[model samples]
Target: MLQKNVLDYLDSSAARFPHKLAFADEARSFTFGQLRACARGLGTALADLGPQHNRPVAVLVNHTAANLAAFFGVLEAGHFYVPLDLQMPLPRLRGILETLSPAALVYPAGEETLAQALADLCPVLCAEEGFAHPPQDALLDARRGRVLDIDPVYAIFTSGSTGTPKGIVIAHRSVIDFTEWMADACQFTHQDVMGNQAPFYFDLSVKDIYLTLKCGATTHIIPKKDFLFPTLLMDFLEEKKVTALVWATSAFHLVANSGVLEKKVPSHLRTVILGGEALQAKQLNRWRAALPAVQYTNLYGPTEVTVDCTWYPIQREFADGERIPIGRACANKEVFLLDEHLQPVPPGQPGELCVRGIGLAKGYFGQWDKTRSAFIQDPRNPNYPDLIYRTGDLAVMDEAGLFTFLTRQDGQIKHMGYRIELGEIETVLNSIPSMEEVACLFDPERDRIHCIYTGSQESKDIAKLARASLPRYMVPNLYHKVAVMPHNPNGKIDRPKLKEEWIHGNDHRL
Candidate 1:
């Protein structure tokens, strides 16, 4: 029988290579059979929660083997899982809970305070104790049989235009399609060893997780703290013999320039995939110079689309500051440039990049208004109605059909592989007992978040307040106090002018 759901991958892998290592983290490792059995046990334990189709079971835990079990468990119970980052602030986490209103909150054991605090909103399931019950084979088989490809497998939350975070739900069919394409395009096999870097909450982990499962490859989860010491990271890679790496641009830059690659090279590293941000030619050259035989690729996509929509395998050398093309769209998917009137733009002209295909998300979890606005009807296909996601990113396609990114059409920025809304940071800054205006800027060269504001509160105090409300990545690294805010002719904040002045050394560092 054809596999219709994501859970089927586990069942097939367990049967084919029951003793083969499926996934390993710093704490422990799990074989294919062990992973499948544990997930089944977890599903049986969560059966009483009434996991219906489309309902969400929010999992709040760190990156660990237990978290993976919770994810598969939710799918086994005929529901979707929303993985939350435990490091996020409580206020931000609460806001997501309010927006999602999940059926239950799944956390690790010994977190009684967290469970009690969120118990009022919904039930909390402990991962350590939750799966203690034996596998209920009948119930698991029944739910598995009912799940369809169109039903959502998981939901990820991204920074919203509004103050709250928006949940983006992806279905099993989308993952199945993208995973199949990636496996064939990249030529993955059971002999490959994947080094997982991105956190489970982030969408980048999707490619690492699903691709490993589809190819029957082993994935070793590098600890977060290891990255701080690049030499230790190199040792881990050398020890695990990681052959493939799908990581953020920052992670590649950190390792390539940390001097560890020059001193000691990863003997088994063969392929390096970068996404979540633009890859600088200088950074690419540094890695290539050290490991000349490695295959490098630039993958681009938003959370709305399953992981990546387009890919560019590096073939030729590039100079410093050169713009890299995002290359063509993936198989079975089409990405074209569309003008403001929803018409096809002329070749070589800048326009919004619109994507049309099955890889698109079902829509925002529950925000009908936002979902309808972003995912609209394809104007060119009026004869038969079809939906295409209007990516707010602007780009230009050349005669060769390759896309070169221009700039973001909105205030959204990808920092440290996280898609953050500048407005979200400004909202929190405005709430901090401030006197006046504020603006957030992402410095691509330095990879820093800059916050400029005209306020009475000290920058240190404001930073402290922000730390309490926002995640560490969203907090501004540099704070500047300006005397007056620049405005355009429309009397609105001239962000361009502010960014120019900040870069040109016209403002005082607070």
Candidate 2:
């Protein structure tokens, strides 16, 4: 049986499968024993810097074997790890640094420029040098002894509407609970080989990393470029003998839409779990037609409630236009809907989806007000100490208790398994000197982002600036420059009219 914390999972797995391959990237792989040794070495190095337990350790590195070791190393040092995207613009990265004020920053060699800039905030430790030191068993053991299951394990920053990124703090218990339920629910085993598709900073990768480690399974870190080339991705999956894939819906669509799956199908794949956006039956049909034996599931959840709170296994076929149901809540988790007045809505009535369970996060780091507002005391439960997360997602429940996703009740959109706030795009665009006004629209049917803006600068130039500040998924693909933005009677930008005009006129430049 898995223990109550992630560290226990690590210790037990390393003891059981000391020589078995645990994690890998494009460059190399690590055995369970080697992973533990490297993490212990880094932990001892970190402990030498002094005791800073309960503080955050910023890890700025690409998705590689070293990065994986550094994550466990942070925990081994009695601190939580915060993974930051190395591609983020310095201005935006600095903003996160201000909010985090991390105890130390860990990065691979050759990032000295970034290390120096943030050195004023905290010490910068090079992972290359840290891992070179001999393992100090006594120091690592002492640091690990201070750790607790309820303590924060990681804090992932997601796009926020307030022109800043919000860090979602998750504890060790939440990961343990979610991973335990996921293993049994998905039927994961030590013999399975898992392919990782999500980035380390994204919440989806949490399942890929922890579940693989806990189950003593091998994890192949698929490269970013391979996803763009479906044929190559399929070949790599076959080469690695990846039997399970927990990827975003867009990834599967890319293969089906690009006609790559027609050329090659991943023969070893047994389980396909898709999330981050609603799955179209058309796309699902393409995969089902090719691989009849594989099990397909649709997962749904926000970062605030861990990776996924609900799941739907695809057993029956659906028409092209039909959307897949998000299914029922996972074991040990509860999902219900509430109207605008915070009262329970009857079946078939649209309501805001709320989730309550052991999978819930610890709330936004350093933003008490924001955390309290979104994660409030459950009004429906007066007898027990209960808290539920208002998911900001509008959904309706059928007679069978399956949830059909309606529309987002907020400015957020899930693209490529990342929850993005459209306001974050406008915030970065509005920062441009020549930008007069900006609005971002999402056509869910097409899974595309349309940007309508009135600005003196060239549209391409605006996009260039956006690319620097925002992740690729959040950057608008279709750009439109208009003489003036449409406004309603209230003098507010008429987003509906703008969307309608774009659809009718076909004025998008790209």
| Candidate with maximal lDDT | 2
List CA RMSD, all candidates. Answer: 10.3, 10.2
- Candidate 2 lDDT: 0.83
Per model, state how many residue pairs clash. Answer: 0, 0
**Local error of candidate 1 at 36, Å?**
0.6
Clashing pairs in 2: none
Cα lDDT for residue 307, candidate 2: 86
TM-scores for every candidate against the unseen true structure = 0.82, 0.82
Query: What digit string (tens of lDDT, one per residue) describes model 2 on residues 1-510?
Result: 535458777888899999999999988889999898888888778888887687899999687878989998888888899999887788878889889989889998888888898788889999878777687888877787777877899999987434468999998988998999999989999998999987888788888899878899999999889966778898999999999998876566556666677788888899999887666676678788889999999999998998889999989987654657999999889999999999999999888999999889999999999999999889997897899999988888999999977656765677777876665566566556466567888766667788898767887888898888778999988788998777432123567677677644454523
Clashing pairs in 1: none
- Per-candidate Cα lDDT values, in order, are 0.82, 0.83
